[model samples]
Target: MFRHTKATDLLNSGVPIHVGMRYMGHKSANMFMHYAQTLSKTHEAEFLRYRKITTDGREYQQDPHEMYEAIALSKRTDRVLPHGYCTLPPRQTCDKGNACLTCTKFVTDESFEPVLRQQMEATDGLIAERQEAHEARFGEPMSQENIWLKGRFQEKNALSKILHTISAVRTSDGTFTPLRGAGSPQGRQEEN
Candidate 1:
């Protein structure tokens, strides 16, 4: 990876972005974004001495302070997502919208189990809330035809499946087999 290279120094030389990456000896744009992300910080972000990859292909930044954080948080700084990490390279836009749980490029480990559980709970509560409001106003439960309610059920189901997988596969100390790169529930089920 590039060690403290200023992007402008290369840009001002009029050599294009790909040439700048070559100057840093980086094989991929993802590697070079490591520095771009760090430089965006107000304080010097600790670029740890040795970053390693797990057998499942997750990158781990071995920062002293980071050990206390979730394993999923140690990703290349720019790739960290809310419930997991995105494998899509940095500076690339995701066209999938907010469906990371069902997107092929997203992955999460045991570290996100708690957060996922809480979300499931929230989704359940919202489903109840919406049903109640619908009944009170319309004199009937929200029909399955309601797109919003349908979406909540889908979200709840996805969350439950993830939690179940985590529980079943977790090792005694709580580490889990990485949820195989996320995709449609059907694809994920087929893999496991």
Candidate 2:
């Protein structure tokens, strides 16, 4: 809910789409490309729920900004969250810009897979439900965004596996063991 509220508020407040993308934890604004689609779909859904359109409906043309207004008007009266903090490091200062692949935040290690998987599943479900409407409005399937998100998630997952293996092979005392050498310090030398 915090994410939705922040995203909705950002859209309504005229915050640049890129700023909202970062606030919503998107790796790239492209993954969050359907901001207008999201607003439009939610607005149309709510509008349809509250008012019935006639069978003799004529051509309907809405102002491009109508969806943005609807989002603001539908704002919940309650706070999005009771408490929260921004723990993520400032990325604006970094020069990576999603190309260098040097930022640790984007990398997955074993510790973050469960969280990543859960997030991926939730995102997939949300995108799936809005699929048809998004395509109709945007002339592109919402899954295109999902595909990019999933690719990033998978890249993180693969990096995590590699890191996990590297860590596992290290000794308790912090020394890395040689993979092909015989076992023990001297290897069958005089039964030492």
Candidate 3:
């Protein structure tokens, strides 16, 4: 994990992958490439920095506290799932074993759409690459990697369906209106 994190951080900070591979003492590019999975937290921070919504040519500035408050408030609800939300008891383990997107306990709102989309795109790319490798090695038939990727693809597809059903209105002030419905408990509370 440390090696992967360091490699990811180095590459994200503008170091070339070849240089990173050399620095990490990796002789095979394929071996080093496995560490290149992007961290969603880092990706989200970068996305937030550059993608602030604008109103009438003015960017809406989100206070750090406001962001923290939003996340904290959401965390208080059992409706919020590990991947999205859960209707189960807050302290109870998921009976479905964390299969969140398709589980009845899972809920999602527009606020999480960007992260879900990012994850979906990443999973799609990963599945394609794994499928290609599996085909090359085995000359057809599903491999364990392919099966895992298929499960991930299905989960992301379910999440995307949830995202599509969410209703978001972009206000003139540049903020998105909170969504309302089964997966949207975040909409019921005011951000502090």
Candidate 4:
């Protein structure tokens, strides 16, 4: 019991795990885990009667920004994008406009797969049309150096990559790809 308490307190206090293990005189990670592990939360979960926490089961009662607004908070809310939402703070507008797929804070899940698919197909078609038009006007095929054309290709590729990750893994109706930053401190700090 004392071993468990000491381990718990040290670990919860943000002590390094290896350091804690050395302080506790444990060598193997298995033993360290055995001493530090606690089942209190898991044990308590058996008493939960209802899984649904809300009426519509959409997660929150209302948009979080609305709650902030009700309290007269000065915080800015997340901007909604076509596929997902931007995590960029109001102070820092994205310079890579229309490149949300490659942006650090551009979070999305399997739910947006349909929109992504449609967008990808549309981009592909548009690229082809634009290429033909460019060739006709310039008497040469659109070079890779064309900024607008290059950007379109990058967007198309990013969409394809995101779609591949989405389809490769799924949880219920949504699969969060590891690339996008959803819960990063940058966005959360601004809200506070």
Name the top lDDT candidate.
4
What lDDT tens digits, residue by residue, belong to model 3 across residues 97-191?
65665565444544565776787787778778878887889899566555686677677667556545542344577545433221233535644
Off by over 4 Å in 4: 1-78, 170-192
- Candidate 3 versus the native: TM-score? 0.43
Candidate 4: tens digits of C-alpha lDDT, residues 1-192: 999998877665546568989999999767777777544332122112111111111222334343323322223334655665555555676787777765665655455678878998999999999999999999999999999888787777677666766666554655332221233344466679
TM-scores for candidates 1 onward, in order = 0.48, 0.24, 0.43, 0.48
- Give per-residue CA lDDT, model 1, range 17-86, as digits (tens): 5776898788887765555433222111221211223213344434323432333244455566566556
Which regions of candidate 2 deviate over 4 angstroms?
1-92, 95-105, 136-192
Best by TM-score: 1
The candidate, 1 or 2, that scores higher on TM-score is 1
Clash pairs for candidate 3: 80-85, 81-84, 81-85, 86-105
Q: Please say which candidate is ahead in TM-score: 3 or 4.
A: 4
RMSD of 2: 25.2
Ten residues in a row with the worst lDDT in model 4? 47-56
**Number of backbone collisions per candidate, in order?**
0, 0, 4, 0
